[model samples]
Target: MDSGIGSQPLQEETADLKAPIAEPSINLDNRIPGLDDPYEHALKPNGDPWAILLKPEMETDKIQCDAWKEEVQTLLIFAGLFSAVVTAFVIESYKFLQPDPNDAIVRLLTQIANGSNATSSPASTSFTATAPSLRINIFWFISLILSLATVLVGTIALQWLREHQAYPACSPKQTLALLRMRSESLEAWHIPQVFAALPLLLQSALVLFLAGLIDFTLPLGPKISIPIACIIGLILVFLACTTILPSFQPLFLLSGRFSRDSVPSPCAFKSPQSQL
Candidate 1:
């Protein structure tokens, strides 16, 4: 051969041109589809357990703060109401103690004089009775008005607090499912709450009315009857509350409902029966 221009041996050149091909190794662990995004592993259509837990924890803190504020307001309203009650008692007591314009003996004498001495009768037989002590009446009236105003204001405040935006006790992914759940199931428990409030309100009004009536009608010497009456009324109220409480237990237990997506939903405060 002519050596084809360059001077290397053919076998050496051929051997240098040949390169070995390496086989690719397969990874079993990395082959998994969701491995790159682990968060997808924790979520489901219904919701993740962790998210559910987080929802309640966050809402609880906010609920607790709201409830505490409501308690403070309730206390203030009660204090104002108490002050009003005391003022009413004082005003009524003073009015009772003050001399009455018409005495039984005076009335009897006046009647006789009017019948027998018609010609000599005083020019004006009319007795212009002074109005109940203006100062005391005004104080009692203002106290009552203020107390009522306080209750109204407190009620408005409570309503505003109730309206504050609340987050579901579950993750956002499951929020739709929670909303789909028939919250009407919760009606069973709410009836008792409504009825309970009614009775309590009635009892309060009755007690207040009785207290005022007793102060105005009964002399202080035999006031023990009022306490006894109040005790009886309280016993009735307690009985009613106890009866209603039992009815509420089942609703309270069912408060945690499963959403359509199977996530645990927020606890309902009122029982289902109340919904009716």
Candidate 2:
């Protein structure tokens, strides 16, 4: 009976040893999932998770760059149109004064003297009649040169952007570098655009002033020419400032960050394993 009891205990112990240990139960709900987990979709072959995240950022940057490029193209077109207008106007005004170019030239000189002496002589009145033509020619000449410069610089920038777009940077580091370089180049190109506006503003103001001068020279009494010219000048100034200023904000932000001699590497955050 004792052997049977002892054997029973031994059998129980043997049974306990043979039984599998109960593993601690895990709460799947509380467990954080990882990208490599089987439940998640598999990554693409040779694909980088970091690169995938960066894709959207790169796309956004590309969109902004394209928009800026279009803006520059529009500015170029406007510059060309302005150049054409100035050239045509100057030519026409020169032809109009050709009957006696010396008369307009003499009139311009006389007017400068008359500015010092408020009272005008009979000869001064005759000279004043031709002064508007000379002033118009001079102002338009300056405007033409400025507008042409804007067109030239804008064209160069546009072509460079096109080429860059065609042969884009292959890697993220290259892309970041290219974007920074393009922004600086764009800022430089924008200088001509902003300066072009100054000449345009001056030319428009001169146009209005000439209208007033011509009014005095005309047999007819004061007319609406000055008011009309003033309105035109205001419109040109508004358009130029509104279009150019917004572009500057973006370029300024971009350039200010990368202006230093030592640019931070885009791959600085990458792991040594990734580099290998």
For every model shown, what is its TM-score relative to the native structure?
0.32, 0.44
Best candidate per TM-score, number? 2
For each of the candidates, the C-alpha root-mean-square deviation to the true structure, in angstroms, is 17.2, 16.5
TM-score of 1: 0.32
* CA deviation > 4 Å runs, candidate 1: 1-64, 67-73, 76-84, 87-108, 111-132, 165-276
Instruction: Tell me how far the alpha carbon of residue 152 in candidate 2 is from the true structure, in angstroms, after superposition.
Output: 0.9
Per-residue lDDT tens digits for candidate 2, residues 129-199, read 26656666666666666566666766766676566555364665455556557657757776435433533
Across 1-276, the per-residue lDDT of candidate 1 in tens digits comes to 467645557767788779675779766576556413456345578855655764774466466546545654764567466656656576655654455655645756776776866335333344432433444344445545545554554565455444433445655545534432323322444422432343234334434544444444334445675776676668767645654665666676578543456654443444322333
User: Model 2 residue 5 lDDT?
Assistant: 81
